[model samples]
Structures are given as C-alpha cells and as structure tokens.
Target: MGELIRLEAGVEHTSWNSSRTKMAAGMSDGSVHIYEPLKGTNSDYSCSNRWKAHEVAVAKLVWAPSEYGDVIACCSKDGTMSIWEEIEDAEKRDVWQLCARFADTKAPVLDLQFANCASGLKLVAAGADAHLRVYEATDVLELKHWQLQAEFANAADVREKLERVSCTDASVCWRPATDPIQQQVFVVGFQTDSPQHSIAKVWEFGEAHQRWHLVAELSSPEHDYGRINHVSWAPNIGRPYELIAVSSSNSLSIWSMDIPSGPGQRPAVKLLGYFTDHQPGEVVQAEWDMSGMTLASAGADGVVRLWQSNLKGRWEEKSRVVGS
Candidate 1:
C-alpha cells in the first residue's frame, strides 16, 4: 500500500463545480479551499487558495452551476449561508473573492439549494431546528420572503426531550425539466427522533398567491430508512424532467412527471428506478451526470463507483475507482 499523495487535510466537506474547472472544500477550521485539478495528471494545477469563510466549522458546501460563473454556496455551523464568487485579476486569472453573504438564521443551516432561480430565483435552507426556510435572493436589503416549511416537534418526537425527528438531515430542491406551469418543484425529507415514519415531501406552487404547496409525501411502509439523505434530478432534463432521490440506505429511487397534453393534461410522477447494491453503511453520496445517463456514487467504504445504462437500456456498473 502506498500513500495518498494528493490528499488535502482539514476538510469537513467538498462540492464539485459544474464546469469541472474547480471544486470547493470546507474545512473544520472554518476555511474554504478551492482547487482546480490538472488534466492528465494526479497533481493539482495550482496552489489552493484558502480563506476564512465561516466563524465556526463549515457544515456544508455546494457549487453553483457554471451558468452562475464562479459563485459557490456554503452553510456553516455559525448559522449562516454565504455565496462567494471569484473576483478576477487584470490578467483574467481567478482571484477568488466574496460575492455576497446571504442571510443569518438562529439555527445552523445544514443543507441548502439554489435551483429555484430559473423561475423566481430563491435560496432555500434546512436548519437544525427542522424548519425549511425559503428566501428570495436579490439586491433588496430586507428578506423578500420567508416561510418555515415544517416542524415535527413534540415530546414524543423528541429523542431526549430536546432534539426531535422533524429535524432535517439533508435537503435538495430542483426545477422540473419543463416549464409548463412556470413554477418550480421542491422535495425535502423530514425526520423526528420519534417512533413514527420519517417523511419526504413534495411541494409545488399553489393556485394563487404564487405560494408553494405540499403535493406528495413519501414514507416507507415498514417505516425504516432513518433519515432522508439527498434529493436529486434525473439526467437529460427535458419537458417535465424526471426526478430521483436517495437516502441513508444504499437505494437510489427514481421518479418522473407525466405532464398532460393538449386541452387537459394533469401531471403525475412515475417511479422509474430503485437501485441498491453497495453494502449498508458503506455508501455516502450519489450524483447523476448532466446527461442523466450515468450516475456516480461514493462513500465510507472508500470506493467511487460509476454506473450507466447501455444503449440497450439496462443499467450496469461501468467502473469503480478506489478512493484515497
């Protein structure tokens, strides 16, 4: 066994950039380090630029899509979410700099997303207290809008009578592939420390007020998968793009929307796939490539596995790279 020469220490989390040009890592010491990997070499092309991004440990990091340029979104234990974009020097090389600090809440924001922008452009966060707050990102000083999405708090829901299950472990909200209604869709997982089933909810824009409404709820019949981990979009997004999600378990479940056509077309979601292979407790993260044809997953067991469906349309394991 040889050493992992390329390893960077102190990082509590990492998020890959959409362009694949750079990636950001959040350190336990409250710093954010952005690294650009060199092509055809195991070594990075340049020195990592580290900055004090948070007052306490950086809890989660997510890179904005390339359409958003150098911007990155991060949530920290200090109870804030910040968006940073590079300020380039005269020579045009990136000199990473702070773009904007969005908002500070009373509780730590564990997970957040920026996918609603194509419609109304908003920022959403799931805090430790188990509330999902959605905010409009704009030049206006005051928060344009905010709503506590859920609260499953109670004595029975509390594990130690202090922490409860309505608490969210992670969250992801994405726009549907199509824009028939001009409103975005959101999916979130809710967990309480109680004996009841944890819930994953679907939300859509309401008939009036431009407000969001809960449309669907997903719960295990046996009530097992302890915490909802992450929700994601299916690849090859088209009109009403397919949706997919995964949890603490090794399963990858897929869903899709059936938009009605012509004069009357009510929408519906089809369960596309539920894939499970990695050993329990061995899997960590899952992502679909832009095409939705391939999936990448990695976890605690130290393996990065790639999966794909052939032209014939049967899914298969393509490759597995050992993680350092």
Candidate 2:
C-alpha cells in the first residue's frame, strides 16, 4: 500500500475544479480544505487553504466554472447550502467569504452542481424530498445575487405537487455545452423506495415557459433498476446524439439520447447497453473522461474499471485498477 497520510478531520466528500488542478475536500467535521498540486516526482499535493464551512457535516461540494473566479458551493446534511468565494487580501493572503446561503430546503441536500448557462451561471440543488431548486445569478460579476428561478420535482411520477419521500441520496449531472446556443439541460436520479421516482430523468429548461420540463427518461422494458446509485452525462463535442451513463447497485447502463433539432420537441432515449458483470457487489459511482469516450466505474469490490467502445462499437471494459 502507498503511504497513508493522516488528516485532521475525516473527509466525507471531495470535488475538483474545472481545470482539475485544484481539489476541494469536505470534511466530516464541517470544514473544507483546498489542495494544490505540487510539481515534483513525489506527486504530492499540499493543502493551500482551509476553513470552517458549516455547522454540520458537508454532503456535497462543487466548484463553479473557472470564468466565475475561485468560487465553490457546498451543501450539508442539515438541508442548507452556501456559496463561498476566495479573494486575495491586500496582505497577499487568501480569504474566503460567504457570498450567499439557501437555508429554506425542506430536506437534507444531497447534491449540488453549477452550470454555465447561456444567460448566466445557475446552481442546482437536489434534496432528499425528490425536489430540485434552481437558482440563477442575476449578474455574473456579482456572485452574491442569486434568485430562485424554478423549483420542481425531478421525476415525472413525483405527483401533483411536492411530496416528501423516503429518499436516501441523489445525483445530478449537467449536459455539456457544445454550441453557442444556450441550452440548459441536466440529468438527475434519486435513491428512494418509489421505483418510478428512483429512475434517472433528463430535464430541460424551457426558455419560453420560464420553467423546467422532462425531456427523456432512461429506462428499459426488460428490467427496472429500482434506485440509481449515480448518473454521469458525457461531454458532446459534435455528436448527433448524447451519451449518459447510469449505474445502479447491481448493473451499469449506457443510454443514447437524441439531440432535438427543433424547439419544443422532447428528446428520445434508447438503451445503448447494459452490463451485470459487476456482480457479487454494488456499483457506487460512474464518471466519464474529458473526451467523453471512456467511462470509469467504481464498485464495492474495490476496483476502478475503465470502459470504452471496441472496433464494432460495442462497449467493453478496457482496463481496471485493484486497490490494495
């Protein structure tokens, strides 16, 4: 095993900035630590900044787009989320200041993500109540001014209004912005008892209606994955269709989504492939590479596997890393 370095507090979650050169760690003690990579053969990282962010353990942390400066959003188990910005003081010291806080959440906030939309920067927060709240910054220059743009259920079967469900976790991923057109889209999944609400769903912001609408649902006629463990939207360079990877406790699936050419048309979803080789264990997370060509998945088996398409366009596991 590699050398184990002790930490002052137990880390609950970690996230990387858009550039991936900086890392932010949320601790179990309600603190956040920022790390910077060091240039050396030792391949080490140094903690450059640390601050107490919340009164409770942090549940999720996400960095804003680099164009938005050194800003980060973090949510806690207490159903509250706050935004922080790092500024350089006159003394050349790093100072983190609170920009805004959203504490009206009805349930524990499970996920937080920042999307660079065509108009401005938007933040999406998913709670254990199976609801999503979107906040948009009125002025990009000022990170403090954010108004709640819309709030709605993440799944279609969420019922007439917001109903509290026994939800445990939730995952959110924004679609890659590939063109000049500002299309606000994202995929969300919930871990709950309700099978319909637990499956992943794609949502798009209707500019005309000024609200969100469900565009597509990733499903199959053969099997119904009860609860999605994680969801990842691949980056689209110029592909006619979009790719989304969804992982569950016992299986992993890839779905192809049609790119709508006209407005007001719902995108169609087709199940590309599904694999059950992650047996005898539960898959925890799935992520795509920067190129959007390869996918990486981690399971309870303590293995990190990379998957890619073969010559015949068949998705297959390319390689794997076994943790010691």
Candidate 3:
C-alpha cells in the first residue's frame, strides 16, 4: 500500500523533514539526493537536487526542525560530520550549501542527533572513539557556528579513567522535554566487543556546573544483554518518570528513570519490561509511539513486532507485521 520512487543511485539512509514536505536520501556512493512532492500530484516525487556529501559512504542524515529553516546534519564513514542548510537564491529558489564540517573525530561517526530544547540547539554524536561529543549553537540563525560543549565516555563513572574501547556502533536519543524545570538529558548505547563496557548510559547536562554528568546506567549484572544496537526515548506526556527502550543483540528492554526532585538526589532507574521471545533474530531497531504507550521493534528476521502495556502495567505483544 506504499508508493515507491525510483532513483538512479542506491540509498543507504533516508530522512524526512519535520514538516514532511521534503525528504533526503543518502546514497551508497557518498551523495545525497533531495526530493519533494511533484506539483499537482499525490504520490509522485521529483528529485530536486543532488550533491556529493562525503568522500565515503553517508551513514546517517537527520533534519532540524522547521524553526531551524531547512537544515540537515550528516554523518559519514570517513569520521566526519557536516551540517548543510538550504538558502534562498536571488530567484527565490532554494540552494543547499554546506554550513559547517567537523573532522576532528578519530573514527567513523556512527550516529548523530539534534535536540532543540529550551536550553538551545544541541547535537550529540557518537563515534568509534568511545565518546559522546556534544555541540551547542547559541544563535539559531547561525547554524555554522557551534561550540564543542562536552565529551565523555558512555559510562556511569566519570571520574575514573576508562580506557578507549573500539565502538562498532552507537545510538543516541534525546529525552523528550515536557517540563521546563527538568534538566536536559539524553541516553547513549555503545556497541563494543568489550563485554564489561557494553551498556546504555543516561547523561544529563548540569546547569549549575556548566558540564555534563552521567546520571544512571541502564543495565544489570545478572543479565548481560550483548552490544546495544538501538535506543529510543519515549515522549512522556503524563508519566511521572521517563521511559526508554533499548535493543541488544537478541533482546529489547524498557527502562523507567525517575528524575531527581531535589539537589544532591540521584536519579533512580528500574527495568520496567523486556522482550526476547517475539524476535527470533537480533533486534536492530526500536521506536516509541507519539504517546509513549506503544513500542515497535524490527529484527534481523525481517519482521516488525508491536508491544504495549496491559492494564496491569505488564508489557505484552500487541501485533506483528511480517516483512517479505
């Protein structure tokens, strides 16, 4: 029941704008294609433009909110991250231009996400260096100017010196902002060969200290769920605590974290639910619905499964969609 658009180049990653009026696809040949709906057509899309984005394969593409004015950030296999913006030309047509490029990373940038919060616009990038780097933009119009705010390993203990572990991949999800008084927080999951270091960690930006701090670790010693492949923070509309879903090699776990009400109070994290039976192979991705009431996960078995909580607050399988 879905419409398809054929492209000359093979796409490796695709992202849609927040307004849903446009879409961008990253090609396997390190190029990016921009498409928009054709005029007076319902399902037809035309490629508006194309550009070479990176020297290596483009791994990910994410668009900023409309308030940011048609901006996108891309991560590549060449250990570089770039931000591009669409500016109107003299003829009133849009032109895509590179706003900034960051190439200081030692390894490939696996994942990057943008968070437009009350604090400001922030970008978090995870790479093979075993570090989650944060960047902040003071002015919204100046998308090119960004300051490196913080860099830390995905671990609960920040003071201790942790050796650099080879991170094969990582996922970063920003906490949905509901309360203005709540501190800014995001979750990072590291996929590494090191069993002791492979885990999910929640990081919070401390306003008082002007730095970032690791708040909670979302794992237990009793069950070692191998390298995490995906993580998604649900949008909490009325829940007292924040909910996050993380997927490992074969299992998916949902965790609830309570925000501290006062100073010097640490956040408490508890495993709310977990799933392993529904998926026959490794779970590659997990996403939460808009209301945070439902979860959907895709596995290597080529199937999509949905999960929801019952009246008793126990999570159960809701439905399944098989893939060809």
Relative to the true structure, candidate 3 reaches a TM of 0.94
Clashing pairs in 2: none
Q: TM-score order of candidates, best first?
A: 2, 3, 1
lDDT tens digits, residue span 1-324, model 1? 643234367778877776666667888888898777556766454445778888888888887655556667788877887777776789986666666664557567878876634543456777777556776655322232333333322222345346443464666666534543455666765444543334556666554655565555554453345555666655545534454555445555555555445322335655544555665653466777777777777756677778776777556679998855
Residues 243-324, candidate 3, lDDT per residue (tens digit)?
8999999688989899788865779999988778545688899999889999999888888889998999888888999986
Off by over 4 Å in 2: 1-8, 38-42, 157-164
Best by lDDT: 2
- Candidate 2 displacement at residue 216 in angstroms: 0.5
Question: 241, model 1: CA deviation in Å?
Answer: 5.8
Clashes of each: 9, 0, 0
Q: Which has the higher TM-score value, candidate number 1 or candidate number 2?
A: 2
